[model samples]
Target: MTNPQLLWLRKNLFNTWYNSLLTIICIAFLIWLAKSIIIWTTTQAQWTVVQVNLRLFLVGRFPQSLYWRVWIVLAIASTLTAITWGVFSSKQHLTKRQIAVYTFIIAGFLMGLPGDLTSRSWLLLISILLAIGFGIGRKFPKIILPWLSLTWLLSFSLIIWLIGGGLGWQSVSTNSWNGLLLTLLMAAVSIVLSFPIGVLLALGRTSNLPIIRWFSILYIEIIRGLPLIGILFLAQVMLPLFLPVDLRLDRVVRAITGLVLFSAAYMAENVRGGLQAVWRGQVEAAKALGLNSLLVTILIILPQALRAVIPAIVGQFIGLFKDTSLLSLVGLVELTGISRSILAQPQFIGRYAEVYLFIGSIYWVFCYSMSLASRRLEKQISQ
Candidate 1:
């Protein structure tokens, strides 16, 4: 090889060697640091008492009888995951790094020396569900839609069954609800409820009728103007007064309703942006082709509009996910609420650092993943 080629080869070799050596050194240092910290903390701190009450931190005072309900919900959620994977199988692919990160997360949940009151069974079930969902998504992409629909239907049915059987919703009161379940439920419900309402609001905003446009504008502006905490307060305190005396809403429902309304306002704005971005010529072309306005908007415009704004919608979702923590302020025990409540316990006093760190890590993982996914979608759409 020429001198230039030799230099290139040497550069590549040096780069590889440098990276390998750095990685090895970093790993060794991390292991040593972790060992030293563990020794110091265990020797100086009283962790055994905390470990014994770990279950309280994880699930709070959930009734033992309703533990099965939580598991059933988890199973249903797993099935839903499998179905979703099936529906979007064509679009699904996981990088090795993603797999490694997920594996590490599972290992942490399973092996981390948390309080001895941990629910190993619940963790086990979630792991199995995730594994099965991933396998099906990878192997049977075509069946995803039907599978997802079936799982959703089953879940809804289960929800109805639980409520009707007089199992009573109080078994899992809004105050007692905490941890990952609350976070997932709030996010899932907010997204589900907001999308249609957002679509309607978007359409109304763009409608030619003055009344429709005015109403839509008013609703969106007023909702968007208020802080989420204000809306949450309305939902928790004021909205209940408007309800019939016989019709009492649960705190969780109120919080979810508040979230859905608050999120829909933002989602409407995003959808409207997408709609506005669609070329007027496309609408005119559809009209000239003898398509009615409804068909034109629905068939020709909305799909592209939605696709164009998916990243924005995803951004809104991630924001909503984080905002769900605010429900803690109104006495709803979501993840942050749970962590704060745990810290208030006499035994866990002064352990706010550990608890908050763990909670922040969990929130960071979820929000970061959502942000990454949104960026990936943006890239794909731009391409």
Candidate 2:
């Protein structure tokens, strides 16, 4: 190592005898842990359980003929994600380290996948679409940014229609929606629906009207007090009793509903904290400018409030995404649910470590992406 590098490390990590001893111990432990994990992954892990059942892990019982729809959904999501990245980031340039990391991740994914032409082709198509979308966003960001919200709303509807299939397309049963597809769908739907409800609840909680304030308080407190598992149970089982005898909501729909309701309560508290942080003077200034309450809140207060709580809101969203695993316990075959089914198979019965580690990695990827995006968005907003 360079003399400067060694000096810097010595100053930071070995400034004292105790510090040097602790650093050495930590390094030893990390090396041992890495060696053990690598040994197990290389020799003991039976990845065939994942490779053979990749489809089941991804889309579950969704019809093979309709796999095109899943590919389309992925392509659309990937493109939108790229566009969002371009919109938020000032520069499209990547550092060498960032480029290397991204390349390694992409290559690892492709190499790990089974050698299926169709899967590879779909992934390649999505990658191309993502690149194109990013370029368009970089070129025409002002034009695209204004319409981006409406575009996202429309795309979500289109995704649902494609997946669920109605209006001239053959109707696929909701039961067929399982694994990662169901997990993402439920998380997306819940997050989207819950945000507005949460905002409204926050507003109502702080409203001038007593009735509205009390109602919002009651709802938020009741929902917050209950366990998420209880809420899921109520949505899945007890919800049916409230409906007409002939009418029944789809299980997936119910699960999303439960998630939305549960998330909104916590979201309300986060928003309320943000709302409290907003200065009263700002609202008064907006009102003095002849703006109505609605205009003042929407134009002046809401933006600042939401900006203040971006991290909290994004953390809640990540929690909501991970919480979708609970749906497996309630009988919806989401990622965790599908894992149980895969494990139930005769050959893969004892492969719990392999199955769980795979899903755990998938969960980590999404949660970390959300966290990274949150940090970027926060930095952009702060600037």
Candidate 3:
């Protein structure tokens, strides 16, 4: 290469390399300074008392007898996660950093630095099960499908057996269901239920039937117009009036119902956007082939629409996960609610900073993972 060209290349490299290096150094220094200040304030200056309460944070005031249910739920969630990972994009793998962080967090939970409030052994067992599930998902994707199906069947059967056989499984009231378990349960159930409802609503909104379209549109608009808190209140207050007098839904059920309805409205809009993205020509082509409208949608349009909207769907799921915290307003003890409860306790009084910070970190991790997964799926779909 000519010296002039070489000089130009050198200049560009110098600018890029020096700029990146400077940015990294600045960030590292800022982080170090922040850490130093925090250490000084917490330990040396005594600006804040650092009372580490890991157990109450993880499991809340969950009773010992029913502690196994929490672990069972975790195991079920892990299996579902592994199934989803395998089914959606088995070729995609977790990064080394992700694996390390997950392992470290689970280990920290098991160690229980402050005290053993919850069962560390159960947490550790669940962690191991999760790790095993992830390994199975990564290495043997084909086997995961059947395993997931079986697990789901067995789980439901167990629930039924508990209810039917009169095993006297000490029922943990929904009010007592607090902490991470409550958050996960609410988010998971809401997302699962909302997805199908959203798809149906989206389809209805776009349908040729005038009555169906109007009803769906009205429902979506009304729900979207109202704040979630209002809807939650409605669920708690007005929902029972609509139902039969004999059936009274619990507070958690009402909260879940409200969440599902609210989320589905937003999800419908997202799916409608995706549906609109389908080329008119493609729909026409399907019609020209004598396919019915349902077939055209299900066989031809819906697949393309969903693929184009996977990122949006994931975004909604993340939103729903965060919104689960809102259930606290209705007396549901999710993660944030549990954190607040902890802060109110005599032992952990005035430790809002630590407790809230910890809860925030947990939320960040889950939201971040969902975002990363969305980006990965986008890349895969593009290719």
Candidate 4:
């Protein structure tokens, strides 16, 4: 019998003399790189910096006694994620490879953090809830799908209320919100707010009215022209001058406002591209059917336009998420900012590589997950 692996190697890596030479050289370089990484990770790296400061990295100066609130929020998020996965991946079975990978990740986290039994128990419970939520979604997708949007909105409101702690609970100042918690909150709020604003801007830019179109174009162009850092600085410094002294905005709120303004411009351009991609024939067809302009736009044009630009829209979202790191520069302690603070400690003074590598891994996990979800959603929409 022909060896399939060998055949594949011959056909691909050894197809021509130059190809074979390039493949050999690439393999050598990769092997050397991998070996170096392994050696440094296993021998030279002191991961105590990461392990000891894990909580600080996750929540910054969040009160330890109030961690249960964070846990509840996490559980809710995990459950929602699982349900979404189940709905979209209904036809796909949980393969053994995927199961193994999930298990390995969970085990790695369990072994890594120096958390006590309570924390581990919370993690386990959240995982179990996620599984239960997935099962519910898979079993009743039709029933659940209709209410998913409403449920997500409610959950987001609940998350914000719990984190911010107002209207009955002891109010935690926004200044205390830091690290990954602040990062996620700012990113989520900005993403949610920016999308609708972007859609409106895109529509305005494409509108028949000269004034609206021109205003949209001017706003989009001016925002897109400025660097995000400059916008954030303006929000932090210049914004206060415009508002009354008594009406001080929280630093976190200012950062989120800046992010939304910056992201919405790019998002407007992305959505505009999608709007332009819609065929003129579709509009004509809808008009011929006696559909008014607004009806045609709402029912026919916008949906198709948004669907066509899903990838671009999601790409913009991913960029916005990563851009939260910039908040640290304006003095907000997001993930990257928190990592710098960690490195400033006496014991971890020289551990820049370890701290940054850990932070980078967190970023990769989130960015890759968003990219993966985008691909999955695109696949589902196509089907």
Candidate 5:
């Protein structure tokens, strides 16, 4: 090989006077930025606050006794993750480096905590076990995927019960939720629960029936036209009043409800775009083959419509995840809110940069993962 690295450098960096100068300036800036980051993290940053409050960062003030239940939920999620990967990635074998990185990550959790086996450690162990579960799940009937989605739905319901305390469990109120737990809970719950609602709204908007289409259009427009924060405010202040005297809407539930409704309106629009992108020929062919209108829409149109909008749907999901931070504005302490609370504490009064950076990184990781997954799915669908 004729030194491909040097060739690339020559072509890209030294091709012109401006190019070489610009590259040198960028390199110098990057080196300076790297040094600053290293110095701040090693010597200036007060990491002890973060370490001490890690649990609060992860779960807020969720009772320590209930911590095990959250871990169990994580284990279930890990198993589901493994099963999904095994099913979808059967043709895409993991590289040795990929396997090693996964193993290292799983193993790192074993020693992440000070204890030999803490809740986090145990939860991480389930990830290792997930590989085994994936093998078993992948061998099941191909029809298991839908059932698996239902399983996840049930699992999510169970988690809500476990955390919020109903059905003979200790009654922890929704107000107690905070930190990353609250953020993930609100975002995940809204995304899952809003999907079906969004689909219905989308269908209604596209329906031949004038009343249904008009109503859907009105609702989607009203919700989308208003700011999300305003909706959250309406949900918080107005929801309880709308209920019977004996009923009360939990603050956490209100926040989630507002998010679901708001996001569903956006989701419905994304899905409508998908519906439009589906070819007219597909519907015509289905009808010609003796499929009824309902069958044609459901069997022939819906999948193509949905597949076309997967990227937009995932983008909405990322937006919804970021929107969870707004719950903090309404006085529900999610990850960002919790960080602000900690920063307001007398001892950490001036640590804005450190705390906000940590909060931002957490949000970035989740959003980035969804973004990357959407790209992968878009590729798969195109293929």
Candidate 6:
């Protein structure tokens, strides 16, 4: 039998002379581009730059002896992700395809790490353990679910101590934090902390209490009115001034604070839109059923409202992930900042393209994963 793909291509691409010509030219260009990229990457490009600077790219100037702390942080994250997937996924399984895709994609770059054979083995072990963790959580959700949130909360505090030190360990100043680790920390912390604040702000904005509503309105408007960079600058410049000298927040903490506050304001608007999308009839229906205001909102209104706005929430999360790069403006060296550090090195001078490309690719993969997850969630919900 004739190939199905070939028949479809003929129908779509060869239906007319102009269409056939266009398709041929496009195919030729793609092939040429692919060949050029392969040649450059394999022959001309100095990928050794990436391999040599792996530590700087991943963790910046963070001390090497303290690297185990990063592994523990990763384990905490892996467990939390497993539990989350087990709790929320329709299949009672973490989506293996997505996890595998990201794992291998990252491994491709990181596995080549020079002189890091043992660490690569550990990385693979962690990946396998994460899958096993997901299975354990999924199978014993009734027994395990209660501890999941508590574990995450504890892990949050533990991560801060491990990364920043000072909890029975040597104090590692936040100023030394940089690289992809810092980028991810800021993004994750901002998104996590922003959620509860956003929910409260959303509820307050919709409250019948005029004072509460107006105060909520004021905060959201004031924060949202300014550019995020301006807010970040203010946080960088102003936060330390108000604190007693001994209590001054570290630069990373200040950046996180600024990100959370700015993101919460935007997220409040997203949540408010979600809240608004709930029909008046739904509220009335719950009220008619003798439900109190809080019960009506909690049991009837919120679930539907949030479900309707999943895409918007995900979009905001992706934006927050990318916006974390803005911390470089305040002298915090996250991914983009780390890239600049690499470029500034005498040995890596004129390698701006490689460094920037690597940084951009990292950002792209993370943002793209969020976008894909959002779409998949929307599809699942609609179905």
Q: Which clashing pairs does model 3 show?
A: none
Q: Which lDDT values do the candidates have, in the order given?
A: 0.76, 0.91, 0.78, 0.89, 0.84, 0.84
User: For model 1, which pairs clash?
Assistant: 51-115, 51-116, 83-148, 86-144, 87-144
Who is ahead in TM-score, 3 or 4?
4
- TM-score of every model? 0.76, 0.95, 0.79, 0.95, 0.92, 0.88
103-163: candidate 5 lDDT, tens digit per residue: 5786676546543257656856785777666665546636666587778888888878777
| Model 3 bad stretches (over 4 Å) | 1-33, 36-53, 83-120, 142-168, 380-383
What stretches of model 4 exceed 4 Å from their correct place?
Answer: 1-4, 94-113
Residue 347, model 4: Cα distance from true site in angstroms: 1.2
TM-score of 3: 0.79
Model 6 segments more than 4 A misplaced? 1-4, 86-113, 141-150, 241-247, 375-383
What clash count does candidate 3 reach?
0
CA lDDT, candidate 3, residue 18: 78
Tens-place lDDT per residue, model 3, 1-383, is 99999887566544587776876798899999999978955675421323454545566677756656655765676656755564556676678798779777866775564435455666666677766666666777676665665676567556434322345656555666678867876887788789989999999999989999999999999999999989999999999999999999988889989999999999999999999999999999999999999899999988999998998999999999999888888887789887777677686677666666678888999999899878866876686
lDDT of 6 by residue, 161-239 (tens): 8898885789887777889999998998899999889988999999989999999999999999999999899998998
Model 1 residue 360 CA deviation (Å) reads: 0.9
Kindly report which residue pairs in candidate 2 clash with one another: none
Candidate 1 per-residue C-alpha lDDT over 1-383 given as tens digits, one digit per residue, 9 for 90 to 100 = 89998787566544687776876798899999999878867676555434665555556666656776666776666556544543344364677697668756864776454423435656666676776676666676655544555567567767545522455554445565676667777887788789889989999999999999999999999999999999999999999899899999988899999999999999999999999989999899889999999899889889989988887898898899989889889888777877777777787788765676666777888888777756655654565
Error in Å for residue 116 of model 4: 0.7
Off by over 4 Å in 1: 1-53, 82-126, 146-175, 372-383
Please give the range of 10 consecutive residues that has the lowest summed lDDT in model 6.
Answer: 85-94
